[model samples]
Target: MDEWVERALARFPNVPALFGWLGLDRRGHWLIQGERISHARIVETIARNYGVDDHGRWFFQNGPQRGYIALEYTPLIASVQADDTLMAHTGRAIESVSALYLDEDSTAVLDTPDGAALVQGADLAWVLDRLRADDSDKEIDDQALSNALAVPSGTQTDLTLVVGNDRLPVYRCDRADIPATLGFVQAPEPRDGENSN
Candidate 1:
């Protein structure tokens, strides 16, 4: 195992670990030791067990869910799916070194390099503190950082003030749900005789 993976594993022994290169398919899904798991499963498990806020950040089972959500933080937009080809292409263009997956409550933290940890709640400050303390030379664009921090706090929507970076938009939701809300057309419905529709 690589040094980072080794360290991450030591940090988060319970959570699964995966590794991947910047753009290449040389990436592995979350796994317990050597057992591989699908990305869909990971997402589903996190969503079902951990509830994600509008900001796309996973949190612990505080409101509705009962467990923790697994977040995937990487420099590269590897798995981010979008309808616009240009956006997808752009995401693939920017390569990232490491990513982080943790619950909002900060109880379980997992990374590609195998450095994992458990904290109390969704302590963004603490996570940022640890990231800064680490020696990794990863570089994340300002916009990405802003998006990450844009997660809603309690019932306030004006939490944009928390983000110190002006480069990132104050309110941004890039997932598929955003497109749907923006009036993106769905696929055409088939005729009654067409394929039993």
Candidate 2:
């Protein structure tokens, strides 16, 4: 959080948190009232203040007020950089990927230090290029990928994602189970007895 935002929080601790007004799309674009936020400065500021509450709900600390963000999928959206490094939507560099998951739609989800992130559609090719066979140096072929996707959800695929010097196991996860598996809430609602607007 910025210094001024911290000060504001201390000064007004009772400000009610806002909801349904802010959202994060799968492509990493921030939206307000379902409209994209194009202002660079505002977008950057929101990203800087973004965080998660104890309840697993992600939000942006807007000075004294909290603006909860409705996630389209995972809290973070990761993209592969030109140097093959991973970067999150919040502009944080992904140091390493601890786990990899593939949903029924074949979208890739990466568990990193920052959080579980869904790979951007544009970077799917990059992820495919790094896929390797289970416990082997050989890469997975087209048939291998097809077979992996054919397995039932919640099953471990015989595939691994090679990122940097780390090799992470790949699991088949259903889209409905993503939030619980990743430990995040996609659409956060107000808790019992809490105020929301």
What's model 1's TM-score? 0.19
Identify the runs in model 1 with alpha carbons over 4 angstroms from their true place: 1-35, 39-43, 52-82, 85-197
Model 2 C-alpha RMSD vs. true structure (Å) is 1.1
Clashing pairs in 2: none
Model 1: per-residue Cα lDDT at residue 150:
57
Candidate 1 accuracy as lDDT: 0.28
Best by TM-score: 2
- Lowest-scoring 10 consecutive residues by lDDT in candidate 2? 188-197
